[model samples]
Target: MDKDISEITDKWKNMNQTHIDTDEKIGPYLDKYFMKYKKTIYDSALSLFYALDTRNLRKSHKHEPISIQALKCFKDFVDRNQATIEEAFLEQKVILPACQFAIYRESETWISTICKYYHVESLPKADRIRLLQKTVNEKKFSSAAWFAIYAKVIREFNLQDIYVPLICQTRISVVEQLMKQDPAIAQDVVACMDKYIDNAGELASFARDIPGANFCLLNDKGIAKFAKRLAREYKVPIQICPRIDYNAKMNAIKFLFRRRYEQRKPMDKRTWETMIDSVFDLDSPASEDNNLVLELIYDLTNYQQYEEARRLAHLHRIPENKWPKLLLSNRSSPDRPLSRLGSGKIISDRNPKLVSVEPEKYSVDLPDDKIFYINSHEKFKEMNSYITKHPLLAIDTEWKPKLGLLNECNPKAALVQIACQDRIFVVDAVELCRDSEWATFVNAIINNPNLIKLGFSIHNDLRAISELIADMNIETKPESFIDYAQFHKSLVQAFKIPLPDYPASSGGLSKLAYTVLGKYLVKDDQYTNWAMRPLTTDKIIYAATDAYVLLEIHEKLESWCQERAINYEVLMKALLKKDSTKNKVNIK
Candidate 1:
């Protein structure tokens, strides 16, 4: 019997090698040769081999798609094991991925089998969307792989123009719970923002409704951005600004403007000057309240809404006895002082330094002792001790640009620059990726809520590399990542200033650095091949400047928050909650 089994196995091997073992051959081979020895180890081992081979087995005649071929193999495996399927999954486990792979290709058989498997009764519910929505049954709907797959189905199916409540509805129902455990999961959904635009409003609204920010991933800046975009799309002026600490040196006039902007009462912004003219007339209570009229002029002037300030001041007939000055002669800039009304208060005292510093003054000057470029595996091991002690870090990555047509593929990562205080560690990702402990090291800093990781448009830098994402297993885990780009938007929305230099929709790192730190980042090296050995001096500086400048930019923004009485750490820490009480209450 042993000799006979060896002979059958040899034929199986030969059949598999030549690609002659089609779905047709596998059945007979399993039935005729292996059927007689079902109880032996050969039956189990050989059965395992043949099941794997069957899954990949193609139909020789029809040239069916891989999805169909796998589905057929799965059906066969189930049919043959129907008697024992309820008791054991030894063979079922081998072919299950076939069903999963089938989700990619649209087929009747694929649809039918899923219905029977899940006991799904409705035909429409078992369709592509229902299955896409059914992914909520998994540990979480935010799986990066499923997010990609579902997005592909949505795009390929041309569901963009039509609003799909079911999509965001499914996500919204469970995200609070999912976020409680992993708030970073919101980052994944936000990462796929371009692919899921149809329901951006619903998603943003749902995010706002999540109540209490801890583990509420969707409520972050990305969704806030989408909310603002939707408002723009509908031709409405949105005031989706982050919470400002009113008690802490906040401008009362600015706060009132923000609150009123939320109501959108002055919908016709084109004619707002004509309308506000009447609201601040002498007969109106605004004129009687001296502080109200003066601050209104101050708020308008501060944001460079000078025409409105001029209109308000002259229209109200600023009496010399009232408080504050109105130097309307030179309302061209915030720097120009306002002349006094009756009460002797000057507007310049309340004016903050709201503009970027001179471009020439902005520089990233790191001493030789401060910069560490690690290119060797030995040097990579020493990285943790150097970086882990700091509670705040500014990180940026560099990679070889992809010259090929497949731009979707991630670039090969070369360097990961981490800046803290006076020290900057330019860790070579190529060498570190080879180390088994590399992912652990990365997660320690990025996922550590106690440690703040700053990046500009950060999700793209970390998520673009599939190889690194898999190595680090960070997709589902909550990343305590602070995307300054979104923060910049919050600042713009709150301040309502015309940022003429860059696109209003985005906060590019260079623009942020220039505006916040008065330093313009030289981005010529951005397109260069980063994987080259013997790193050039220009590459090192360019990389170091990107990471190092973030530290200063963050400090400037932090001061802005402090001046407004906003707690920067509290906002960041809110997103990093590892677990939430809400999860235990509603999660089933």
Candidate 2:
């Protein structure tokens, strides 16, 4: 054991270092060289990095100067190999630094790049889109043509579900062109506006960044049809006026509606009201605009109970009222032909057995769309369409009834209910008492010799109506206004029909209804306060029911006359000609 020390020492010696110890030798030498000339080496390495790595150099020397020669050389390299670099970018060069070296010179290049990027199959769709987003962030494009391309690409990539309003924002204007080229894109544009704007947001906010307003969206045949559809879909003030050939069919202006959020619940009454109000924007509607409001509402409430709602054959009757006795023809417009329905709607069409056995059933059985509360001029204007569409009207007046005989302060008819074939308008007598325009329109409509107006005990009502309409100084009553009371009397006498329980119109509209149609007007409330603002729902229902029932009563009485082989039109004319003082009727 003691003799092994020499062997161990020899073995250790034989395993000695044959190669140079590079780490040991070089450590101090490098330290001595770099320590002596450290600044020069550091500067040289940094300069090389600045020349080669323009990205990081740009970051570090953002406010400082770099080598101009290096920059020039790099620019020269990019310029000389521009095509090669872009081609490489095309061939799946996923490196973004190569992109920066290439396309960030200006935004038009970015726009061009985004359009070209759509076809670069080498890169994945997501990556191409990411690059597009980077470019988009650099500059937002305001070119309509570029927007149209996006409208195309959006469908191509099927990104429509993500950007609905933006799709509607961009695609609506260019839909006709896009449709002919790629029907999928045009239809998608239409589909993008599938949901009602529904108080999504205010118009000003939606138009926050109108991309290409300076450009005309479209001015062709498609635009009117497109604008009409948009009018059905519009909300913003920009949408209120789609100025084209107003007569060139109905067109809707493409308004950029920015969605606030996708509300996924039923709206409250107020919200629902606002939504309907916006869609039926009437005050600034186009001169030749379709009766879009009535048409749409008719559809919404087009139930079996109110089958008359579907009576608008073309939804094309509004502007036709400019001529009270406009000749019915197979063609109204030069290019597009129009026709009238063979059997026009009448009060009989609205007769749906609406009367209830239960006395407490208070509602008028009318959808909110069927009732127009015309408190403002806007609402009055909205009703003008219905007025034009259906000249035959049923009318009634509501006044704050004199509480006592000493009440010398004569209350004007607080409101007047005008019931046409399909809708009821409650005109605010108080609000419009001084509006000369309102008086003039009312005068013209009432005096339209061809119109057939129906009312019960209308003598006092016509006088009240004239007084309420301050300016026209209506010296005479409505020329064609027929008193339902006298008509019933004429029907009973001329046709020898059975006498009703209530013989006199003085018995009231309710008793008269009960006598004629078996559907008495429900007493809304015992205490009548008609002059109240925001008239109570019960009051509105009652008022509308009163006037609307006059038409119903007349329909039943006329049918009786027809059944009895009596000429109802001649009977009505005799009733209109006769005075209340002489309670006898003469149809000759």
lDDT of 2 by residue, 1-588 (tens): 112223322222232233333323323433333234333432322233233344332312222222222233333444554454433223343333333333343223333443343233344557655654554444332222333344234443443432332333445443343344454454444444322232223322443454432223223333334443543333222333334223222211111010101112122223233333333235654443455434432332321212222223223344434322312232242211112211232112111244324223223556878988887776776676558567678888888543211112345677888898678888888888765456545655666666777887777677677667645565444667777665566556656678544323224666667677654455524235566566677667778887887777777877877887777777666655655323367654
Give the top-scoring candidate (TM-score): 1
Candidate that would win on lDDT: 1
The true-versus-predicted C-alpha distance at residue 354 of model 1, in Å, is 19
User: Each candidate's lDDT (Cα)?
Assistant: 0.49, 0.47
Those runs of model 1 whose alpha carbons end farther than 4 Å from true positions after fitting are 1-358, 404-409, 464-466, 469-478, 494-507, 575-588
Candidate 1 lDDT over residue span 1-588, tens digit each: 545445544554456568774445545544543345444322243344334445454434434433344345445655675565442223334223333433333333543454344223322323545445444344233332233232334333222211222234334433332223332333333334433333345555644433232333343344444433332232221112111111111233333344323222222232233323323325533213445567677766654456656666667666644423444545443423222221222222111244333344345766877788887666666776668788888888887543211112356457888899888888777766666546556567665666777787676666544456575554434356677766666555654434445323223787787677655666544544466566777678779888989899878777877776767666546534523111111111
Q: Write down the worst ten-residue block by lDDT for model 1.
A: 240-249
Clashes of each: 9, 5
Clashes of 2: 5
